[model samples]
Target: MIEFKNVSKTFTAKEGTVHAVKDVNLTIPDGKIYGIVGYSGAGKSTIIRMLNGLEFPTTGSVTINGSEISSLKGKELREQRLKIGMVFQHFNLLWSRTVLENIEFPLEIAKVAKEERRQKAQKLVALVGLEGRENAYPSELSGGQKQRVGIARALANDPEILLSDEATSALDPQTTDEVLDLLIDINKKLNLTVVVITHEMHVIRKICDHVAVLDAGKIVEQGPVLDVFKNPQQAITKRFVNQETSSASLDDTTVVVSELLEKYPNGLIVRLTFHGDQAKLPIVSEMLRQFPDVDLSIIEGNIHQTQEGALGSLYIQLLSEHHDSLQGALEYFNTMRVETEVIKREQ
Candidate 1:
């Protein structure tokens, strides 16, 4: 397990003392994909730097499996860092080196024999689906190919923890998904712990099992990816969650709801949220059958899958001559464990 206990970091800049990180206590269980997401200057870089021992925490400790990394000196620190490999954002490859050489670079630094590193790099080249491109230089490979090489190289040392710092920020959407899928495969195959540091919430939604939302160096909200998506507490976190949501989603359906309300002014508009298996249930159909006096119109809906399960959001307009029928239908949905919110009630 990796842990940061009451960690904080400060810097003496040209202007004044700046606190890069403040009172962060985070735990990352072994063999799990974890994500730390925040905008620029939110201390994400500082946190990762401290984790790899490149920078020490000002007031606390960073420990990986009971070993204090911050206290280590010289050789010990170097060895510790080797156990944690970093994948950079810009594909920081050697201009002259080919893919295989880039994959072999770390092992070369560790002084592994030339033959041994060659064999290892070859195997990694195949592992990352770069077998045919092993001899291609960084300049020749595409963005995704270069990232694959970067990943292969990070795994050259068989790191226990992989730190991906904005590794996909520069890639297109399709390539971003491809890289994320590769990381997931690597995590499962190697049983390795992966820590992704990104500003993109979509990156967090795509790969991370657990996430922490950072703002101004503090953790505002965090939990399993599915939980946070279903219910985001902080304003920043809600904004992040809303980014991945469809424009017609329940989180930001103001315009859609307005149009629906204007067109069907004599009804109640509600937002329904379904968790896991609930998303698959025919609750709305059942509502129609059981509450015959009510009329329901499905507006917009979407289902998002996370590492945990499926989270579904739907918007519907319920119309009835009687208010009790609408309330009864809502109560029925409540008993079925579907979350409901009345978006706009007829005035």
Candidate 2:
């Protein structure tokens, strides 16, 4: 397991001192896909740097397994680094090197035999679905292929932990999903603990088992992926969750709601939130069947599948001449363990 104990970092530059990270405490379990999410300059890079021993913390300590990373030096630090592989945002491959050669670079630096490294690189090329592109150079590959090479290179040393730093920020939406799916494949096949740092929340929803939300140099929120998505507490976290919960913006949601209100002025806009197996249950159909006197219309709804489980958000307008039926439907949702919120009641 990796533990960050009261960790904080500061920089003494021309502008005096700046606290980059403030008292971050986190524990990442072994073999779990963990994500650290934040906007630009939220101390994410600092934490990654500290993980690889690139920078020492000003206070507290970072420990992985049994080693104190901040105190390691020279040979100790170098050896510890070999156990952690890092995939960069940019491909960061040697422009002159072929895909096979790039994958062999790490082993070459460690002074492994040329024949042995080449053999390992060939297997990795196939593992990352770059079998035909092994001889191709960085320039010859697409953005996604280049990242595949980067991932293959990171695994050259067969590290137990893989760190990805904005690895898909440059790719298009489809390519991003492809890359994320590849990472998930790698995680399951190797049982490697994966750490992904990015500003995008959909990335977390797609791959991470657990997530930590950073804002203004502190971890304002964190938990299992499903729990966080099901109930985001902080404003920063809600902003992130909204990115996956629905495609519509708040303004768009409001506009649709306004139109719904105009049509069904006495309707109650009920928002239903459920997680995991609740998505498969026949709660909605049952509600409709039981409440035959009421009218139910779906406004907007989506079920997002996370690495941990599934989370769904559904907005339905309930209308009836009598208010009792609307209230009865709300009570039925409560018994089904669905979180319900009345978005608007125009009675």
Candidate 3:
């Protein structure tokens, strides 16, 4: 329901002009949690701000629900913003206000009746599992609870979409999972489209069905989360995926593979990646029976769960006394549709 077409944003600083977002085009489907991941200065935050009309592009257009958001201003933009809710890394709650008051603040700004606002706020508190904390101030709540209040306040106007900007970055791992589960529930129950911008891969892996990998103010890769994670085509994408999987670095794997090559010139060391039901295959055992001397040594691996299925990778040393047998095993791997790369031995 959101589209960015040839959108570019430039900032004029004393040093020079900076292109925060450059010719970035993307489409976010409705009723899905979409993630934009990048490092500090990758312009991910700028992309999300454009959705709420909080930031406008220097050139091109941003269309939300079929209307150009950049063309709106004043009352027009304010009215449109009500349909889009946002939560921040920090709770951003008014410390002096009680939980009920904070949740009611947005309603008050919208000029809802006092009694109606109170009732709406009460229901929201219950929705976020903070019913008894209605009277407690923000200072009394834990990080996760404070975020729940932020969520309740954001939903005061019954927004159709939610923008989460590093929503769980400041919390502990336990608290992060709690907040993520809450977001997933809210998305399903409310049928709300979500756009989450964060550097953490765990956030994307947990909830996002679609993802875009950003680097230097440009999108290097974008696709279904599982597909992107299974076979990353870009270096930046591989770096992030590897971080989440915590797979041993390619350099380290290369070192071990190189040592094996020195000992056995005829052997081949290949990296293999398996996904979905393929992970359960008895392919390795079957291969050993077919070629008695072919040895498969798994150096490092991990199984990552995505909405689609399980994805696993392994580095193996395939040993055979003859070159013909080694080539035959490589061909067998190709037939299984398993991704494999030969580790070239240095001359």
Candidate 4:
């Protein structure tokens, strides 16, 4: 397990001091994929660097298992670092080295026998599906393949934890998904604890079991992926979640609601939120069946799959000669564990 206890980091420059991370606290359980998400300058990279002792916190502690990484120094820090491996966004491989040689570089630093290193590298090559490319240099590989090499190298030391710092930002969407899936496979196969730092919400949605949302050096929100996605409390976090679902912004959604209200003055506009099994049920069809006197039309809707399950949101217009049934319909939806909000009622 990794714990960040009141951790904060600051950097001093000729200009002045900058606080890259604020008083943040987080716990990442072992064998699970955790994500730290934020925009540029949000201190996500600082957090990842601190994990392996590459950067020390200005205050508080970063502890893996029971060791406080911030206090370790010299040989102690180096030894502790060997247990934690890092994968970079740029695929930091030696251009002159072949795939097998690059993966063996860390084992060489540890003074492993050349033959043993070769065996380890060969095993890793197969683990990462780079079998035929073992003799190829970094230049000969695609973006996804290069990242696979980087991942294999990071695992050369058989580290317990792997830190990925914007590891997919440089890749195209398809390549990013490929790398992400590989990471998931590695996590399950090796039972390795993986921490990913990225600005992309899709990355979080795809693989992370838990997530921390950062903005301006402070964590605005953090929780299990499903809970955060279903009920985001902060404006920044909501924006990030919307980005993944391709949902409209609050203002834009309000404008849409207003236009719908103008077009159908007697219609009722409602917003529905679904979580888990609720998203899979045919709630709209049920509603129409229950209230045959009322006409229901979907204006806009989206359903997205996350690590937890399906999360969906929909905007619907309800029309009826009798308006009282709408309230009863909403109450029925509430009893079914679906969140219902009447955005606009007949006026």
Report model 1's TM-score to 2 decimal places.
Answer: 0.94
Per-residue lDDT for 215-257 in model 1, tens only? 9999898899988987888999988887775545544467767
State model 4's lDDT. Answer: 0.91
Each candidate: RMSD: 2.2, 2.0, 2.2, 2.3
Model 1 clashing-pair count: 0
Q: State residue 61's C-alpha deviation in candidate 3, in Å.
A: 0.4
lDDT of 3 by residue, 1-347 (tens): 99999999999999999999999999999999999999989999999999999899999899988999989999999999988999999989998899999999989988999999999999999999997889999999999999999999999999989999999999999999999999989999999999999999888888898999999999999999988987899999988987786467667766877888898787788877788888889877777787787877877777777667877777788887777778888788778877777878777
Q: Candidate 4 — which residues are off by over 4 angstroms? A: 247-255, 344-347
Best by TM-score: 2
Sliding window of 10 residues with minimal summed lDDT for model 1? 245-254
Tens digits of per-residue lDDT, candidate 2, 45-121, equal: 89888999988899999999978999999998999999899999998999999999999999987889999999999
lDDT of 1 at 242: 72
Error of 1 at 94 (Å): 1.0
Q: Count steric clashes of candidate 4.
A: 0
Q: What are the lDDT figures for the candidates, one per model? A: 0.90, 0.91, 0.89, 0.91
The superposed Cα distance between candidate 4 and the true structure at residue 220, in angstroms, equals 1.3
| Total clashing pairs in model 3 | 0
